[model samples]
Target: MTLVRDIREDDAQDWRRLWAGYNDFYEASVPTEVTEYTWRRLLDPTSSLIGRIAEIDARVVGFSVSVLHDSSWTSSPICYLEDLFVDPSLRSGGVGRALIQDLVDLGRARGWSRLYWHTQANNQRARRLYDAFVEADDFVRYRLTL
Candidate 1:
């Protein structure tokens, strides 16, 4: 069974390994400083961001990051599942599902109006799991990189 728990100060080393795997899967080279900043943000009590890690047999195998913000459509805040990643070697062992399910439970506890996330259209593996949970809406995302 996978244990899903909040990120801790001592989790940096293991979390970095999973973080690197996530970046590798996306073919992006994020700088170490950015990761350090993100780690700090995740631990900041005032920050809206939340992070959770999945471990099996005491080894970290996956992680999820999320945020809650006010929604225009409802008074309750909406949750954005910013990132989800599991070690490729352990992909099919329910780590990802456990991480997401934990986030969903957390979001509901916090009174979030909705919980959502975005991913590359080509990420078929992830899409398959997501598809089993919710129907895709007819919405497209656009962005301008600063």
Candidate 2:
């Protein structure tokens, strides 16, 4: 059974391992400074960033990081599920789905206006899991690094 819970201070090492795997999967080379900053923000009580851990039999198997933000389109806050990763060996074993469901349940309980996320078009495995929750919407995302 998978148990989903908030990230604790002692989870830093495991979280870092999973975080590196996540970056590798996306071919992202996030600098060390930024990673440390993100870690600090997640642990800051005043920050909107949140982190969650997924464990099975006391071993950390996956993790999710998100942020709550105000939206111009709604009165309540919205949650953007920024990062989610499971051990590659554990894919399709329900860990990912459980993480997402935990967020959905959290959003509802917190009265969030919406919960959303995006993934690469070619990620069919992830798409299949995501589609089980909701269909992909007709929106194109544009990013500009400044």
lDDT of each: 0.89, 0.96
TM-score, model 2 to reference = 0.98
Candidate 2, residues 69-91, lDDT tens digits: the string is 99999999999999999999899
By summed lDDT, the worst window of 10 consecutive residues in model 1 runs over 128-137
Clashing pairs for model 1 are none
Clashes of each: 0, 0
Q: What TM-score do all the candidates reach, one by one?
A: 0.96, 0.98
Error of 2 at 108 (Å): 0.6
Q: What ranges in model 1 sit over 4 Å off?
A: none
Q: Which candidate has the top score in lDDT?
A: 2
Q: How far off is residue 21 in model 2, in Å?
A: 0.3
Q: Any idea what lDDT model 1 has?
A: 0.89
**Model 1 / residue 36 / CA error / Å:** 0.7
lDDT string for model 1 (4-113, tens) is: 99999889999989899899989999998999999999888889888899999999889998987887899998889999999899887788889888978887887778
